[model samples]
Target: GESVGLHLPTLSVQEGDNSIINCAYSNSASDYFIWYKQESGKGPQFIIDIRSNMDKRQGQRVTVLLNKTVKHLSLQIAATQPGDSAVYFCAEKKGSNYKLTFGKGTLLTVNP
Candidate 1:
């Protein structure tokens, strides 16, 4: 099935550096967006989210931006640490749908 995907399959960054992960979604009608970070064994943990009505939202040490014009979404992490290394994914829900279509995970590697 068609779904969202990241431009880069993996991102490499140094510790304490700001990390920006970009995602491209094909569905313009998707009204809700979420970013998740998954550790090696755990399930995806919600990092941040944004509604279509808004352009941007922020959480602790993280920010999610929604660009409806280009169907683009990005998650920015501040002061990224080695502990922040994980696979990140973006999911989108269209209308009132309960199921979220997720993008191919982007592996973030933080070098010390």
Candidate 2:
């Protein structure tokens, strides 16, 4: 995630509650999206993905949704725990290109 003087968005939730993080992408042609979770002092870890052809996909305790019509993407975390506290990014890839444009992530804090 790259930010030009822009602060990342933040979301706070109680442990055991659900968390929803949202991202808006500029490229409508982006056909693939992947979400990554990054903890402090660690690299971003792949969490989930959703293709433009599909509206939703679920993995483990996370769900990803793509709204191509609005160029919007969302990640839903079920039963958020302290381990889930991290910066989550949504990156999009277009066509056959493996390169992705990442959004400035949202910082999720799970309060116990």
Candidate 3:
């Protein structure tokens, strides 16, 4: 069977440094990508998102980049903090479908 999506399982970064998390999606038909962060005992929170029409999108301290050609997506966080430590995941939406396919999460630890 073909893989639908892929993501790193873990990431560690020093406080005050930048963090970059990578993901690869196999569904070329997907048109929307979203990044989410989940803290311990809590639900995932939306971080940032990028549409297929755009290559990059930025939030307050987060940025999302999408490369359709390579079926890759990346999330960049500036000045990582201890509070930023969490599991991050990417979800993809194909066309107008209401359901989203979630990738394997990456647990990020920010060392203080």
C-alpha local distance difference test of each model: 0.94, 0.86, 0.89
- Off by more than 4 A, model 3: 1-4
Top TM-score prediction, candidate number: 1
For each candidate in turn, the TM-score is 0.96, 0.91, 0.95
What is candidate 1's lDDT per residue for 45-93, written digit by digit as tens? 9899999999999899999999989899999999999999999999999
Which segments of candidate 1 are over 4 A away from where they belong?
none
CA lDDT for candidate 1: 0.94
Clashing residue pairs for model 3: none
Q: Is candidate 1 or candidate 2 better by TM-score?
A: 1
Q: Rank the candidates by TM-score, best first.
A: 1, 3, 2
Model 2 alpha-carbon miss at residue 91, Å: 0.2
lDDT tens per residue, model 3, 23-93:
99888889999998999999999998889999999999899999999999999999999999999999999
Ranking by lDDT: 1, 3, 2
Better of 2 and 3 by lDDT: 3
Q: For candidate 2, write residues 1-112 as lDDT tens digits.
A: 3321113499999999999998888777788989999999999999998888999999999999887787778899999999999999888888998888787889999999
**TM-score of candidate 3 on Cα atoms, chains taken together:** 0.95
